[model samples]
Target: MLRPFLMFASLAFFAFSAPVQTPPPSGAPAAAPAPAVPADAAQTPNPVKPTAESQARAKQIYGYDCALCHGEKGDGKGDVAADMKTPMGDFTSSATLKSMTDGELYYVILKGKGQMPPEEGRAKPAEIWNLVIYLRSMSKQ
Candidate 1:
């Protein structure tokens, strides 16, 4: 009798202890939220000067983290990008980044856009700035 009671108690405790998540009423997800870009994002300037060493570090980071979706050449043709419905922007094209400022890029990198998760904690602020510079160079090349 005691063993049976303990089993029932354990079962009740587990059933209540687990988290409960209800499905949405619509049974579908809402649209993706707009990235949190500041009004001054366009005015933000790149504080990190592009040096060979900084660019190299950015390259290493990009290769490991971003190359899966952003391509090795910044051409938006990474392996994962082929599976995505929305195409990644081509950094090799000057027109692709002509309107965006350094700050805007920084915000996108730090906060994330669409399916791209925020790169926060993966790199320092200065390294992100270096990534922006590295991306800009892709168009020039």
Candidate 2:
């Protein structure tokens, strides 16, 4: 009789001690916004001129680094673009290029924007300027 009573007490204690799971809140905080680019950084001009040699170098670099996501033709329809969470910029559109200045492009390339990774450490400043020229060519197409 005592053994049965002890077993019953143990079961009752375990049942009461079981953790209670509460439903999560309906609303959760949104993710933090991306950092804003400074006026000077956005206004900084590209010192490199668009020469054939520079453009060729830029093309090579872009093919190796940017073409995977920016597309081989710079149309923003790259192979991996569909799988990316962020929206890719359409470089082939004149309207899009017209709105953004060289400085803004430089800043974006250096610091990265939205889901784009920064090319600061990976690419030199001259190479980045060349890339800016290559991007300009994309708009003309």
Candidate 3:
């Protein structure tokens, strides 16, 4: 009985003791920065940050294009929100916005998440930037 138990323990130990495989050693410097992704491939796309004039232009465009779903106050409770299956995001939450990069925001706006549809045709580039700025501004409050 002891002999059988010892054999089983040895087999178990061997089974658990397989050498861990290490990843390939980093012999060379890291690769260069990747190129930006194009608008066509990604569901949500981030555009480069806009200039002041463009930002202001973005605001107007946002009011015209985005206010329906995002709300006039950026609170995610726009009038049309009732029509959506997914509720709009609550922009006032710093915790939620801080983790997301500008690019991530762009992607969400360009590519609708869950119930939201992509804004690609609904908004021009400038309009999207305004929404980004609005989201960024939400961080302060």
Candidate 4:
């Protein structure tokens, strides 16, 4: 009877005690409320419209090497355009770049056009593909 009474008293005491509130796990930080901002700032920037990785690669190569002969924006009005004996075609014209295929452009890049030196030793096949993508992008079609 004494043992049973002692057990009942211990159970009662434990039941009356406050519940143990476990703290958050270690290394975890409490989240803070988000700050309010202007509605305009909430608008995300325009997504990249390149649409394809190849197009992006082409733009990169054009900016690096061809931009001198072809404008940085491919307007065909690059800095070297004036000095070059054979005028570089205006890429922004749309009609010109549209007609040519990736193969044709690659050939020109490899063989060089008029005064434009062949990049045979300088650029690899993959790099030339990028240039083709950039040229195709210039076309309106």
Candidate 5:
């Protein structure tokens, strides 16, 4: 369908573009932003290994879609978040991501929570999983 195609195209465009980094007006809590998810999904483990290719692709995708609100460095201080007055969790901190499994993160991306939009139609499950890996890698930096 055209809708699916459009979604893919837009996603591709964002993936190819550079990310914008802007600090949020204020700091957000170090608390985990774990949205509600089914236990089964939350327990799901990450299948994809952290690789240069996957991380690169995930970075690209995050740059376009997530960086707008989640920040370029995953500090949760993107320009959009500042304007929206959103308290996005900082991925740079270990505590923020410690309690969340890769599956839980994937669920949030696939289904979306709060103002976040689901990547369901726009990206394949593999890509979403890869994104989870990329998010986990943020704390290491």
Candidate 6:
């Protein structure tokens, strides 16, 4: 009788101890906007010119770090983009590029946004400026 009682108690304890799975809320709050970039940071211009050599180096760096999500051509159609919850922006679009300043792009690259991880330490300041130049060129293509 005691054995049967202990088994029932154990079963009850296990059932209650198991984590309860709940579905996501039907109406979630809207996501907060990205934090504002500092005035000094935003105003800092890209000292690196968009030269052929700089672009070549930028292309190599972009392929290794950004191509996974931004696509080889910067069209926002990279292989991993399909799996991402948020859609990637097409750098090839003039409308998209027109609104963003070089400094803003640099800030985003350094700090990251949403699903993108920060590239601050991964690339030097000069390299990041080169990336900004490369990104600007994408809109012209």
In terms of lDDT, the best-performing candidate is 5
lDDT of 6 by residue, 1-141 (tens): 999999999999999999996654634434445757888888888887677887899999999899889989999988878665447889999887787788889998888876677788999988899999898889898
What is the TM-score of each predicted model, taking all chains together?
0.75, 0.72, 0.53, 0.55, 0.74, 0.74
lDDT of 3 by residue, 88-139 (tens): 6677777767766666677677766554557789887656756787677765
CA error at residue 53 for candidate 2, angstroms: 1.2
Which residue runs does candidate 3 get wrong by more than 4 Å?
1-50, 83-85, 121-130
What's the CA error at residue 124 for candidate 5, in Å?
1.0
Query: Weakest 10 consecutive residues, lDDT, candidate 5?
Result: 24-33
lDDT against the true structure, per candidate, is 0.86, 0.81, 0.68, 0.65, 0.88, 0.84
| Model 5: lDDT of residue 133 | 85
RMSD to true structure for each model, in Å = 5.4, 7.8, 13.9, 23.1, 16.2, 5.3
Could you give candidate 2's per-residue lDDT for residues 1-141 as a string of tens digits?
999999999999999999996653533333244557788877888898788888999999989888888889888878877665336778888777787788888888887765567899999999998898899898886
Q: Write the residue-wise lDDT of candidate 4 on 1-141 in tens digits.
A: 999999999999998895986664643343233333334433423233445776777677678778887778777788877564336677777777665555566667766765566778887767675676667667553
Candidate 4 clash figure, as a count? 1
What are the runs in model 1 whose C-alpha is more than 4 Å off? 1-31
Best by TM-score: 1
TM-score of 3: 0.53
Tens-digit lDDT track of model 1 for 12-126: 9999999998875755544357587887976888988888899999989889888889899999999987765448889999999998889999999988877687889978999
Clashing pairs in 1: none
Sort the predicted structures by lDDT, highest score first. 5, 1, 6, 2, 3, 4
